[model samples]
Target: MENDAETEKEKKNKNNKVIVGSIICTLLVIYLGMATYFRTHFYFGTEINCVNVSAKTIKEAAKQMTSQMESYKLSLKEKSGKTEQITSTEINLKLSSNDEFKRLKDKQGSFNWIFGALDSKNSKLKANIIYSNKLLQEKINNLSCLDSKNIIEPKNPSFKYSSTGYVVLNEVNGNKIDKDVLYKNIVNALSTGTTTLNLDSTNCYLKPKYTVKSKKTSEIKNILNKYVSSKIIYTFGDKKEVIDGSKINKWLNVDDNYEVVFDNSILTKYMRKLFSNYETIGKTRNFVTTSGNTISIGGGDYGWDINSSEDIQKLIDDIKNGRTVTREPIYLQTAASHSSDDIGNTYVEIDMVNQHLWFYKKGSLVTQGDVVTGNMSLNTSTPAGVYRLKYKERNATLKGEGYASPVNFWMPFNGGIGIHDASWRSSFGGNIYLTSGSHGCVNAPYYLAQTLYNNIDAGTPVVCYY
Candidate 1:
C-alpha cells in the first residue's frame, strides 16, 4: 500500500507540470500576437521612417531642405547665350519644406519620440536618410539661384533688381521697383553706410545745358555814336526844309556836268541826315499884293516902278510918315520860351553862306527863312552886319525911274544898300548876283519883304553875317 501511494503522487505531479506548461504556452502565444499587432500598428500608422521613404517623401524632403537656405552669393557664366558674366551679391531662398524628409521629421515630433520606439538600426537609417535629403535640397535650392525667368533670385524675394545683377524672386507680377525710387534708395544706402554694392554698367541721366547769344550790345554802340556826332539845321519858306553840309552841291562827289535837281536821291539822303531831329517851326508862302499901279509886292520883296518920279516922291513920303505911325507888333513862338509874348520883340539873322535867315524871339528860333542875299560886289553888294528895319512904304520908286507902286520893309543895310522889295527879278538861286543889276539894295521877293515890313516895327534887330 505505501508503494502504490508513492507512485500515484509522482503521477499527479507530472500531470500538474504538463497542465502548467500548456497554459504558459498559450499565454506566450497571446503575448506574441499582441506585441506584433502593436508594433505593426504604430510603425505603419504613426511612425515615419525616413529611411524607407517613397518618392513623394523624397520630393517633400527636397522642398523642405531648400526652405532653410540663407542668403548667398552667386555668379552666372553666360547671359542671353553670350559669354558675358553676371554676378549676384546677395540672394535668399523661400522653399517649400513639404518634400524634405529631414525637415518633416524634425517638425513631426520631439527627438525622443522620433527615436524612442524605433529600433536602433531603423533609427540610424532614418537619421541618415533625413540628413541626406536636407543636404541634397540645400544644394538644389542654391543651384536654382536663377528662377524660371532666368533672373537671379534673392531672399525675401522682393521684385527689385539690385545693381549686383540680383533679381528678387517670387514677387507678385507687375510689382517692379520704380527707377527713381531705386536710385534714391541706392544713394541713401551708400551715404548712410547701410550696404555696399558695386555699381558697374549703370547709366547716369543728366540734363543738357544750352547757351544763348546777344545782339543788342553791338547795335547799341552804333546808335550811340550816331547820336553823339549829328547836328540838325532847319530852314523855313514857302515850305519848310533842312539843309546841311551834306546837301551842298560842291560838297558832293559828282561830275561837274551833272545838273543835280533839288529832288535827287543824294539830296534826299542829305536832307534826311541833316534834319534827323529837327522840330517844325512854321511855314510861310509867297503871295502878291497891289496898291495901285505904282507898286506891286510879291514873295520876299517889293517891285519899284523906276520910270516914274511921282512914284519915287510917294515912296519917300510914305517911308518918313510910316516911321512915326504905330501898329501892333507881330509875335513868334518857340519850344524853350513857350511864347513870344514875354520877349515881345523879334530879331533876324541872315546867313549869306547858307542862304538862310533865322528869326529869334524869346531866346528861341521862331522862324527860319531862305533868303537871296545881295550880289557879292563892291558897288551893288549888300553889307552883312547887324542893322535895323528903318522904314516901310506901300508905294515907292527911285527918282527919274518908273514907279514902284508898292514897297515893303526897307532896311538901310549899308547907306541905302540894305534888304528891300524887288518884284521884277526872276532868278533867285545860284550865282545870279554876279551881274551888277541892283542899285545897292538887297532886293528880296516883294511879298516876303512886305510881310517882314508888316510884321516888324522900324527898330527890329536884323543881323546879317556869312
Candidate 2:
C-alpha cells in the first residue's frame, strides 16, 4: 500500500512540471513575437516629431508623417487676440525623408520595447523639413500683423497735464510684429511639426520702449510732478504775482526717453513777458506837474529794469528744488517807489515853457528860481522828459562848441546838460530861451544852484517837461 501511494505522488508531480513548462513556453513565444514585431513597427506609445507613430511600420509612419506635414498649418495667436494661419501649401512645406526614423528605432532597441511601451517615449526625429525660403518669407510678410495698414504702432508711456497736476499716460499694446522673432518661431514650429504657435507667448509683438510699469516711467512722473508742484509768489509792493502749477505745467515736459525736461525758452519768454509788464523805464507815465495839468511823459531811463537772464536761471533752480517762497526778481535798476508814479516827493521839476525851476524836498519847495533853458532859435532846446541826476560838482568850468563859462555849482541831470549858476546871464526866465538862452543848460541864479547842489541827492529824478 505504501509503494502504490508513492507512485501516485510521483505521477502528480510530473503532471505539475509539464503544466508549468507549457505556460513558460507560451509566454516566451509571445515575448519573442512582440520583439520581432517591434523590429519593423514602432513600439506602443511611440511618437516622432510630435506625431503619434505607435504600432506603425516605418513606411506607414513616414506616410502618416508626410500626410500630416502636407496638412500642417501653424495658427499664430496675436497680441490683439486675433488668430491667423500659415498653411504648408502657402509656404510649399515638405518632409524630406531621411534615416532619422531608422536610427531612432535602432537607438530604442526592440529588447527595450517593453519598457518603452510601459512608459511614454517621446522621440524627436529631425524630419529634415524643407520649404521655399522665399515663399515662407512671403507668407510671413502677408500675415495680418505684418500689414502696415492693419498694424497699430506701440506707444511708450508718457506724461499729460491734467486739471490738477501731471499724470502718467499708459503704454499702448500694439499689433506690430517682430518679424525676425516671428519668422524664427515659425521655422521652429514647422521643423517640429507643431500645429499651433502663440505669437504672444513667443513675445513676437513689438513692445513699447517704456511701459507704465517701467521704473523710468514712474521716475519721470515723479520728476514732472515735483517740477509742477512749486509755488512762487512774486511781491510787487502791494501787488502779488503768483507763479504756481498752472503756469509751471506749461514749462514742464517729458522727453522721448522718458526723462523730465524743462523748456528754458518758454521760461525765458515768460520772463520777457514779466519784463514787458513790470518794466518802468521808457514806459509811458501819466504825471501831474506843479501847474496841475496831467501830462503823458513817455521817455526816461529812471525806473525799474529787470535782469531777465539771471532771473530765468534762478527760476529754473527754484522749480528744480521745488521751492515755495515770496520774492522779487533780480533788478538791473530800481525806482524810489513801486507806485503809479515812480518819482517820489523829493525831485527837481523844471518848467521849460515858463523857463523856471522848482526843487522840491519831501513835497515842499526847497528853492525856486527863474531859469534860461536853451536857445530854441539854434535848435538846441532842452529835451522834454524825466531824468535822474547824474552828479553834483563845485567850481566847474562848462565848455561848449562856441564858449567856455565858469560856474559856482554844477548839477548835471541829462547828458551834457545841467543846472548851473551862470554869471554870464544878467537876467533870467521868459522868451529869452526862444532867442538867446544858455546852450541846453538851466542857467540858474547862484543862490538857487548852490541850494540844489547842497541839498539834492544823486539819482533823484529830474522832471523837465514843456
Candidate 3:
C-alpha cells in the first residue's frame, strides 16, 4: 500500500510538470505572435528618405508620404529679392505605384522582426515618383516674373556730359528670368527631391549682355568720356558759341576696330551758319566821310570774310586732341577799326557830273580842285565808284591801252586814270571833255596836281561817283 501510494504521487507530479511545460510553451507562442507583429510592418527605428516610417506598414507608409507630398510647396527666391512658390498642384506632383516602393519595403528587414527592432541604422530611401515636367515648365513660364511684359531689359553703360564735364554712367542689369537655367535647376531640384530653389544663389536668372565692366562697353564709355573733356568756345566780334565735349561726343563714331571718326558735315554746317551771320562784303552799307558827308556805299572788297573751311578743319583737330581754348575765327579780309562801312574817313571824293575833286586827311578837308574827266561823247567817261590810290610821281609820262600823255605831276588813283598836270590846257573843269577830253583820265591844272601829289599817298581810298 505504501509503494502504490508513492507511485501515485510521482505520477501526479509528472502530470503537473507536463501541464506547466505546455502552458509555458503556449505563452511563449503568444509572445512570439505579439513581437513578430513587426514582421509585416517597419522596424521600430526605420527611416526612409529621411522620413520616419517606424511602426508603419508598407501601404501605410506610402499613403502617409503621398498625402504629405500633396501639400508640398517649394519656396523659390527671385532676382529682385522677391519670394515665389511652386505648388504640387502646379507640377502634378504625385506618388507612382511602382516596384521601387516594394523594393524599399523589402529592404526594411521586416520579416526578421527581432533584428529590425534591435537595429538603429539610418537609411536613405527613394520612393517612386511621378510628376509632369511639361506642367512644371508651363507653370514656371506662366509666372508673372517670367512674363515678357514684366521682364526688364538690361541697359548698357553710357558716357554722358554735363556742366560737371565727362561722366561715366553705370549700367542697369535689371531683372531677367532665364528659362533654360531656371528650368534646369527646377528639374534638378524636383528629381532630387529638393524643397527650396534660390534663383539668386543658383545663378538661374539671366545676366545683362552689357555690364559696366564689359570690355566693349567700358571701351566705348572711356572713349566718349575722353572725347567730352575738351571745351572749345568759338567767338566772332560779338558772337560766341560754346562747344563742350558733350556735343563733340555726339558727332563722334566708332568702328568695330575702335577707330574714332568725327562728322565733318556737322562741322561744315556749323561753319556755314557762322559765315552766314558774320560775313560782310557784297552787302549794302552806309558810310560817313571826313567832310561830314553821309554816303550809302554798296560796292567794295573791304570787309571781314571768315575762312570757313580751313577753320572748321582746325576745330576738328582741336576737339580730337581734347583742347580747351577761347579764340577768334580766321578771316580773309579786314575792315577799319570801329567802322561799320569798312571805309574810314580819310579818302578822296570826286563828282563826275560836277567835275570836282576833294581830299581829306584824318576827317578834315585838306585840299580841293576842279578836274576834267574822260570824254563823254565817245563813252570813255571817267569810271565811277570806289578805288584806291596806286602811286605818285614828280614828273612822268603815262601810257594807256590807246594813248600816251605827258604830265608834270602824276597821282594815279584808278586804273589808267590819274590826277596829272595838264599844262597843255589853259582851262580846267566844265564841258571841254565833250569833244577834246583825255581818255579816262582826270586832267588837272599844274599847280593843283602838285598840291594833290604832295598830299596823297599810295593805298589811299579814291571815291569817284556821278
Assess each prediction's global lDDT (C-alpha) against the native: 0.38, 0.85, 0.72
Clashing pairs in 2: none
* Candidate 3, position 367, lDDT: 79
Q: Give lDDT tens digits, candidate 2, residues 1-466.
A: 9999999999999999999999999988988988898888887878877888998888898889888888888998877778899999998898776477887777777766777756544344556888999999888878877889998988898678876777787888777888899899999999888888999888888889988888888888788888888888887778778888888988887777666788888978887997667778877888888889999887867788888888888888999989998899889887778888988888888899999899999989899999999899989898888888888988999998888888889988888998999887789998899999878988998888989999998889888888
The TM-score measured for candidate 1 stands at: 0.24
How do the residues 1-466 of candidate 3 rate in per-residue lDDT, one tens digit apiece? 9999999999999999999999999977876774677556676656654467777777888887777678777778877667788888888887676355556556665455556645544234556567998898788888878888878876555556666654557766667867788888876666556788988789876665665667876667666666677777877656677888646766776543444577778757866786666665554566554356676755544356778887877787777677899987777654443245455667777776777788877778887878888998988887766666777887688887775777889887666677788877888778777877778888887777777788877767777766
Q: How accurate is candidate 2 locally (lDDT)?
A: 0.85
In terms of lDDT, the poorest run of 10 residues in model 3 is 334-343
TM-score of each: 0.24, 0.73, 0.46
Model 2 weakest lDDT span, ten residues long: 117-126
Compute the lDDT of residue 152 as modeled in candidate 2: 91
Full candidate order by TM-score, most accurate first:
2, 3, 1
Higher-ranked by lDDT: 2 or 3: 2
Better of 1 and 2 by lDDT: 2
Candidate 1 ranges with C-alpha deviation above 4 Å: 1-345, 363-368, 399-409
The best candidate by TM-score is 2
Which lDDT tens digits does candidate 1 get at residues 287-380? Answer: 1111112211112221111222332233223332322222211112222212221113356656555555555554566645455666566354
How much is the lDDT of residue 42 in candidate 2? 81
